[model samples]
Target: MTAADQPPQGGRGPRRAVAAAERTRQPTEVRRRLIVDAAVPLIAERGYASVGVRDVAAAAGVSVGTVTYHFGSVQEVLSEAMVLHIERYYTALSEAAEHATTAAEALRLLVDALFTEDTDRHWRMWFEYWHAGEQGTDEAFARGQADRYAAWHRQIRALAERGVGDGEFSCDDLDGFTTRFAALADGLALQRLRQAPPLTTQEARHHLNRFIERELTPRSPL
Candidate 1:
C-alpha cells in the first residue's frame, strides 16, 4: 500500500497505530537503502569535497536530520557505501570463479569483471577516492583504497594459482603475478578514466587477455 493508505499513529484508532508502526518498520529498511543508493553516485560523480549533507538528503528525499540520524557524517555514509559496493563486487567474482572451468577462464573472468562496463561507477568512485586520499585531508579515503587493494590482491592470488595449475601461465612467482596484474588493472582504469571515449568493455577484455597471454607464453621450447 502507499503512504496515504497507512494509518496515522496516535491520530485515529488502534488500526492507525498498527499501520503506522508497520509503515515505520518498512521505511527504516527502505530509507537506509535509498540513502546509500543516492550517496554512491553523488559522492562518486561529484567527489565528497563538492557535495554536502543537504544534497544527499535531498537526493534521498529525506531531510538533513534524517541523513545525520542514520549516518552521522558524510564520511560515514560514504564508507558504508564502499563496503556495500565491495560486498557486491566479491559476490560477483565468486560466481564468476565458480563457473570458470580452467585457470585461464577464471583469470579472464576476473579481469573482465574488473573492467566490466557495469563498473563505471566503481571506477569513478575509486578514482575520486584516490584523488582525495592523495590530498592528505581524508584518512578514511586512504584507508579505503588500501583495504580494497588488499582484497583484490587476495582474489588475484587465488586466480593466479588456478591459472598456473591449468598451464595457462608459466609464472612460478604467484605473489608477483597477482601484485602486477592487480596494478595493471588499476593503472589502466586510471588512464582510461581520463582518456577520450573511455575504454570500451570489449577493449578492456582484449587488453587483459593479451597481457595474460604474453605473461603465460613460454620462450621457445626450452
Candidate 2:
C-alpha cells in the first residue's frame, strides 16, 4: 500500500517500537492529575492570576515545561480546579437532596450542611470563586456562579412544588419564591461564616425553618 499507511520498512519496526516507547514514556493521566491537584491549593490560596505555570510546576515538583505540557495555560488549570470544586459541592448538594423528605426539611438540611462546623473549608473555596467571578476574567468562573445559583434554585423549586402538593405551603410563583428563599439561605450562610461565634447548625436550621414556616403556613388551609 502507500508508504504512510504501510508498516515500517526498516524490517526491525524500529519506528513503531520508538513510537510505542514514547507513548509509554509519557505520563498522561498522572501529569493531568498532578496539575489539577497542585492547582487547587495554590489557586485557593493565591488565586488564578497570581499563580503561573512555573509556580504550579514548582508546587507540583515537576518542571515548568511539564506544567505547560499538561495544561496549555494557567487559565486552563484554574478552570479544571474550579470544576473540581463544583463537583465537590454538587456531591454534597446531591447527598442533601436525597436526605431531605419535605421541602422545609430540605432547605434546613441544605443550610445546615453549608454552615456546619466541617464545611468551613468548602465555604472558603466558594468565597475564592465568588471573588474570581466578580473580576470576570474567566468565563468558567462566571458560569460557575450561575451554575450554583441555578442548581440551588432547582432544588428549592422542587421543594416548593412538593410543599404545595402536600398542602404545607401556598405559592403561585414558584420561581420567584424559590429565588428569594435561596437568597435568604445564602445570606444567612455568609453571615454564619463571616460572623464571630457563627450560628450553630441547629440555630441556622431553626432560623431557616421559622422563615419557611412563616411564609408557607397556609392561612385558610389552602
Candidate 3:
C-alpha cells in the first residue's frame, strides 16, 4: 500500500504521519542537508547495502518523493552521505595533529581518536564503501573511494613529513610507509569491527603502536 493508505498500527499513527510530524518546518536547504545527515546513522545501523531510498526517507522524516526530489537517485544520496560521514573522521585526525606540539604526541592523539568508543559503526560504513569499490558494482562508489583514499594517503604522508622535519620519526620510504600504514589501520579497524571476537580495540591499537615504534622511531646517532 502507499504511505497514505497505511493505517495507524498500535495507535501511534501511520508511519507517514509520524515522519511528517517529527520533522519541524525548515528551509529547503536545511531539509536537504538533514536528509543526507539522517542517512548516516541508518547506514551505520543497517549497513549501507541494506539502506534504500525508503530507509533514507523514513530516517529523514521525509517522504520518498521528497528524497528523490533532492537527489537524482538513492545512489547519489548514499554517495553524499559517505562524504559527510568521513568529514568527521578526517577532521578529528586533523585536529589531533593541529593541537599537538610534537609529532609523537600527534601520533598518539591520532591513534586514540582513530579507535574511538564508537568506531565500530564508523568503520562499518567505510568498509561497505570499500567493498562496493572492490566489487565494481557502483561507479560513484568507486570514484569516491579513490578520492577519499588519496586524501587519506596525503594525510598520513603529511604526518610523516612533519615527523621527519621535527627529527622525531624517520622513514626511508615516506610514500610506501604512508600507504602501508593506511592499509594497516584499515585492516585493524575491519578486524575490530567484525563479529565472532576477531580482536579488541586495545589489541588493535597495541599492534598498530608496535608497528609505529618499529618503523617510524628515529634511529640513534652513530
Best by TM-score: 3
Question: Residue-wise lDDT of candidate 1 within 103-189, one digit each (tens)?
Answer: 777877787788766787788776665665676555666777788778778887877776666656677677876777777887788
* Candidates sorted by lDDT, best first: 3, 1, 2
Ranking by TM-score: 3, 1, 2
Q: What ranges in model 1 sit over 4 Å off?
A: 1-31, 135-145, 166-168, 196-199, 217-222
lDDT on C-alpha atoms for all candidate structures: 0.73, 0.71, 0.80
Point out where model 3 deviates above 4 Å: 1-27, 135-141, 195-197, 219-222
Give the RMSD in angstroms, all C-alphas superposed, for model 3: 5.1
Query: Model 2 — TM-score against the truth?
Result: 0.70
lDDT of 3: 0.80
Best by lDDT: 3
Residue-level lDDT tens digits of model 2 in 19-137:
44664576798668767887788876775668888888778766676677767677777777766876777677768867777666666676666666766556656666676678767
Q: Model 3: per-residue lDDT, tens digit, 1-222?
A: 997677667756665566665554667788789999999888788876789999999888778988998898887787778778887778877977888898777777777777867788789888877765675576767777888889888887888789888788788888988877888898889778764467877788887777778879775665
Give the local distance difference test score of model 2.
Answer: 0.71
Q: Clashing residue pairs, candidate 1?
A: none
Candidate closer to the true structure by TM-score (higher is better), 1 or 3? 3
Please list the residue runs of candidate 2 whose C-alpha ends up more than 4 Å from where it truly belongs after superposition.
1-30, 45-55, 196-202, 218-222
